[model samples]
Target: NRALYRAKFDAVTARLSATLDTVTPPAGFYLWPKTPVSDTVFARGLLEKTNVAVLPGSYLGREVDGINPGANHVRLALVATLEETLEAADRIADFMAQCYSA
Candidate 1:
């Protein structure tokens, strides 16, 4: 049932949060709004530069007004190793900084 599935998802997310040193969402219904576009480009540059892979938000039907809502956003896999993820995050940050500086 949906309730059971939700419970399992919450449990898994909790474990992932603990492992990743991230915060868990408050206990309640949660909606993961698609990542905004600004985040997408940063993520893509990171993956392309680092050889890591991620999905763009537009691929998830977040496109709007003929514009990709996630055009600036990238979808990272929580399943990747922590080190790989950290590297991706670092790359994204650097790329974004460079973009703004230019």
Candidate 2:
């Protein structure tokens, strides 16, 4: 059910130290995590290395007052099967940990 997806999403973010900034999505399968680095870079690296697709927060917002409020964030949609979602979470956690520790 919905709870399963939310729980998985929460677990992943909790492990990554990535802030889940958006108010619990009212009705969607997305988890928006504030990244430790540029979101675009993070997204690209994730896709290239882990084969996971994440939307850079920059693509979800517009620049205003010389700043794109969406900077340093990425959006993940836990819309796959439970097994796949967990696997993706694991890969993402490792990817982010590596990026941050480097």
Candidate 3:
């Protein structure tokens, strides 16, 4: 099951790579992407405009010792079907273009 998820995750990341700054997911059903803007802004804007929800990186971990390692990133869960994940990725790319154009 893990291998299957990883394969799907890889396919999603490969498609998103052209627009999003994504690292190869280590494990689990999430993709941790470093967005061009603040994580909160990126997450909110995408959610509001494209209806693609993402978990802000800051929420995944604590600001340990006043240092937030996840401040500029967001998490995208690939727990849905492949088609849904791919569609969400496309929406995210469109949202990013809209945001950067202005």
TM-score of each predicted structure versus truth: 0.45, 0.80, 0.88
Per-model lDDT: 0.47, 0.77, 0.85
For 1-102, candidate 3 gives per-residue lDDT tens digits of 887788778887787787788877576788898888889998999999999999999888789899888888998988888788889988987887777644
Count residue pairs with overlapping backbones in model 2.
0
How far out, in Å, is residue 32 in model 1?
Answer: 7.2
**Candidate 2 per-residue C-alpha lDDT over 10-85 given as tens digits, one digit per residue, 9 for 90 to 100:** 6655655552343455567777778777999989999998999999999999999989988888888888887788
Q: Give the clashing residue pairs of candidate 3, or none.
A: none
Evaluated at residue 58, the lDDT of candidate 3 is 87
| Model 1 TM-score, 2 decimals | 0.45
The lDDT ranking, best first, is 3, 2, 1
Q: Global lDDT for candidate 1?
A: 0.47
Candidate 3 TM-score over all chains jointly: 0.88
| Better TM-score candidate (2, 3) | 3
Candidate closest to the true structure, highest lDDT: 3
